[model samples]
Target: MAEPSTARTLTTEPRRTPPAPRSVGAYPLLAWTWMRAMAQYPVSLLLLTFGQAASTGLELTALFFVFGHAHQLAGFGINEALLIYGLAGVAFCLADFFMGSVERLGEHVRKGSFDTMLVRPVSPLVQLATDEFSPRRLGKVVPAVAALCYALAVLDIDWTPARILMLPVLIVSSIVICCCVWTLGASIQFFIADAREVANSVTYGGQAMTEYPLAIYGRSVVRTATFVVPLAFASWQPALFLLDRPDPTGLPEWLRYAAPGVALLMSLAATLAWRTGLRHYRSTGS
Candidate 1:
């Protein structure tokens, strides 16, 4: 009878927005985990580190032998040659320590393990590079630093303000160039599963070539290194600026300052190659 029934109001709680996904700390986390695992075996780590140092030390010995045969190589005195060797060694060792593991991409692709990296919420490059990170690789830096110090002390360089600034810039650019080369070489693995040897020939062989005066390799080799791979920027070109020396191959004086730009271009090329390789990758379907 009575039409005064109060209508019940339906109330709904505000929907809470789901929290955003957290950023993945890929490289630091994986690298730390590997470092912890390696720490569990102290003696093995020490021995492996020492072995790495000894192997690189032999390269220095070879340099001394080269100098013993003559006071100058390709018109570069012993000190100048040592400067090149030291700078190249430091750059290569630093690059290898960080990016060397990328070379295993071929093995990962062959075994179908690379597929797992694709599904993770992280860049595969960081994961692959930090995988099984080893402290032993830092061992090579010891001799390289020592050699650099000795060369800097003994070389009669007239260090102007520009040269002083160029020293660190050159070293940093060389490291970037070397790392780019590693990534570029690793990109080849996506197409050629067994191309590790070929990649090594480019990355390691380039390092070997850079560890001395490019002048010793003849004009043809110098030209190839300059225009083809740009390996000359890793040590030769910027080093000439640092030492206030002329390019033995008669490259333009401005080329001495081109290392940083070359490194940037190499970085862009490497990044593009890696992305293209990833797009073309086919899973092993294991």
Candidate 2:
């Protein structure tokens, strides 16, 4: 009995380590989560999407009406103008789809909900941008894509290898520049809580401005957009190159290829602004 008692000992399993936290896939995961939530009510999503598509269609109709009356706008024919509109629309839609929700930063800051994002493992920018992700925004892309495809099909251009490559490059650069502008706008909210309208003026206003030939605007306005705001690179400059048209504003033809460089610089500035804003952020004390 004593020997049996001495032999009575318990054995346990080895302890397992916990998994590592996510570094990547955080944005898509959060965006997908909100998307799934929205998908629960398919009818509402469809209606909202339809509304978006309809609104975009109306804008295109207005463009057609304008073209019907005037065969050319600012020296650009119907197809050329449509190319500009389509390029601007696609770029703006993509930026808005990805980063538009960042505009609500002011609301989050005011409600003190932004503090919650700081405690999470994911990036605050990623969290904010992916918040309330909706598929309705994608509906706007349909008309834009249709316009682009139609323009590309009808527009008679000498498509070179370089020109063909520049098409995607211009689109990508425009998207990046728009995204940077959105980030810069969001960063401004860190200082001024009511800057949403001002930010929208830049983002939305820039989209509207780029949808047509820059030649329609005054030289001062065109220069401001080109050198100061760099919005010209979004559509006008690249479209000039694509159409083999000269700059009515007297800007150098080489500026057409400068979109990528401008986009890189804008990216740097936006990143710096965002980091500075984050460092200066104060909790709402909720």
Candidate 3:
């Protein structure tokens, strides 16, 4: 009787189910934390943001001046080129502002600080991106957004409801492309120990290439960028849609909508590569 009663009591006690994993919110939770932290470090952030703004503004101004005189390259005008540059600018800076700090993976691994990241409940990549928020690079975003807005106003955008809808979609595609490139560079750090130069080339090269008509480039370069690096969809293809110019590259019109999808796929691939690399992660000293 005593044993039966004890067994019943034990069986009646509620079993604690493990907490369900929280859904990743619409805005990356880590990105929100970074925005808050940047708010806290106001002065340093402002100075950096302003400095970046000044430098980038000068570069864009120079580009405008040079291209303005010529008026066209490979059947593209100054305004059209600026549109491409402006969009690419926002993409690159957002990636830097959000996850730029993570580009220092080699240093973190070398110093053995990566282990500290491993112990956390959240992802190391998320933690890494949030670790340092540069308030200054945010200066770049304002001008880029302004340029985009102004360009849309000044240029004939053929603003149908569908085209209008695609505007925000284009910006997101740009962001994904930039972040994917950055993430890919960071992933290489897991293997090469110090992939800084190669990383810079990949990130900066894509940005530089997107500033002009990709059509002028040779087939070999174009193929390498298309299948290998994937800079084509981010700027080249979408620019065709924006300029109302038919894609001379023979890519379909419907493909413009696919840019964001391609970007998402690339980002997912980079993430999977990151996870696989993490499994083989040998902290620098070991």
Put down candidate 3 lDDT per residue, 1-286, tens digits, no spaces: 3576665544577789867544355127766677788788788777877888987787678778868688777777777777777777778878787777778888889988888988766678877776665567688777766776676677877877877788778878878877888888988899998896799897877777776677667566766766677777766766777778876655567766777778978989899889987998998655
- Clashing pairs for predicted structure model 3, backbone only: 48-136, 49-136
TM per candidate = 0.91, 0.92, 0.84
Better-scoring candidate (TM-score), 1 or 3: 1
Candidate that scores best on lDDT: 2
Enumerate clash totals for all models, in the order shown.
0, 0, 2
Q: Point out the worst 10-residue segment of candidate 3 by lDDT.
A: 18-27
Distance (Å) between predicted and true CA of 190, model 2?
0.3
Question: Can you write out model 2's per-residue Cα lDDT over 134-185, one digit (the tens) per residue?
Answer: 9899998888889988998999988999999999998999999999999999
Q: Distance (Å) between predicted and true CA of 123, model 2?
A: 0.8
- Model 2 pairs in collision: none
Ranking by TM-score: 2, 1, 3
**Candidate 1 Cα outliers beyond 4 Å, as residue runs:** 1-25
Which of 2 and 3 is ahead in lDDT? 2
Cα deviation of 280, candidate 3, in Å: 1.1
Best candidate, TM-score: 2
**What global local distance difference test value does model 1 have?**
0.88
